[model samples]
Target: MKNEEKTKKRKAKRKLSTGLYKLAFFYAVLLLIIGFTLGVVYDSFISKGMEDEINKIIELSTTSEILYASGEEFCTIFPRTMKEIEEQTWKLGVMIDELESKNRIGEDLKLKYFDLQVRDFFLVKKASKECRINPLIIMYFYTNNLVECEECYEQGFELAIARNSLLEKVPIKIYAFEGKTSHSVVNYFKEKYNISSYPSLVFIYLEDGEERWLKEEGLINSNQILEKALTFQNASS
Candidate 1:
């Protein structure tokens, strides 16, 4: 009778152990499937976002060219086109920033984004020349994840407000770039402009039929910057 009782207990314990193993295996498989599905969805979302940005750029380029050829002023196209481009640019920046925060961005996407930015910069240059309007290019450079300058944010905010105020007088565009950008174009800009610090502002204008860049650092006074911009415009004109 004792031997039978011991045999029964051993069989029951083995059954329970087998059931637990099966449950664990089932959960592991479920979790893997969920992870894979989420990964696919997220990848698709990222690709779609990039595609939208490219499309906006293409549309902006085409529309601006058409408007210019039709004898439209730079400010005239603002409500219909330029404003949208500006908004999209801001949105793109925010999206990339969020991705950077999550550390989910890949090198390939960053390279592509940088390439797009270079193209956009050239587009702005073309617009400035062809449109023949008061064009202001503020090149804002700073570290994304690190603070290279303590006053960079304040300086940037000041410039942004200044840009808004002069939007009517001058067709101003702000191109915010990461100082530690790996893009070769940024590297070229850094070398050409002698950018050595964070929160560097490069004010570019056409001087003597040649594109010129002016760098500003330290505590930025928006009013002073605006005056210089006006002077630059007058000189160019």
Candidate 2:
């Protein structure tokens, strides 16, 4: 009777483990499918000339300022791509927050997300340069693990509120990035900026005819954000 009971317990444990693995896998697949579906639907609506705008961005990646000769040129096509960049990056930020909240994100989706973010980061730079505006940049970096970086979502929420408040007064823009992606661009900035911790914010602004940045670790309130943002806002003015 003892030997029979032992065999039954072993089989039961195996079945339970298998069920948990399947549940995790189902969540991963469902998230990816939802992501892909949303991408397809969004592209269909904004399909016209989107490819050309992206190519322009890609060219800017190589030549940087050369492609952006005049504000007029970028002004014409840049609005559409600008809209695309903002939507893509912002939506992914929301998706990341949602995934972390539910604890259901997979490794594959995160890699894809990081790629879009890096690309859109370049687009933001391109837009600022061509538009001849020294926008106050708020770069929020965090990871997928909620347990590791629980404050990340709160940071995002506070920054969103700060942006809403400061947009008219300071020209502030907030962008969220996944800090632990394997993407080379993400890795490069991580090393260059000494980003050793999660829930990091990098504030980039124009000062003394050059670009400068201030890095902060952990969560910060909207009031603090408004303080630093207004400082840059004054400097640029």
Off by over 4 Å in 1: 1-47, 62-83, 98-104, 219-221
Candidate 1: pairs in clash: none
**Tens digit per residue, CA lDDT, model 2, 105-138:** 5555555556656765666666765565567887
**Best-matching candidate per lDDT:** 1
| Per-model TM-score versus the true fold | 0.65, 0.63
Query: Model 1, 166-189: lDDT tens per residue?
Result: 777876667777777788898888
Predictions in order: lDDT = 0.72, 0.68
- Give Cα distance to truth, residue 8, candidate 2, Å: 38
Q: What are the RMSD figures for all models against the true structure?
A: 6.1, 10.5
lDDT score at residue 42, model 2, on the 0-100 scale: 64
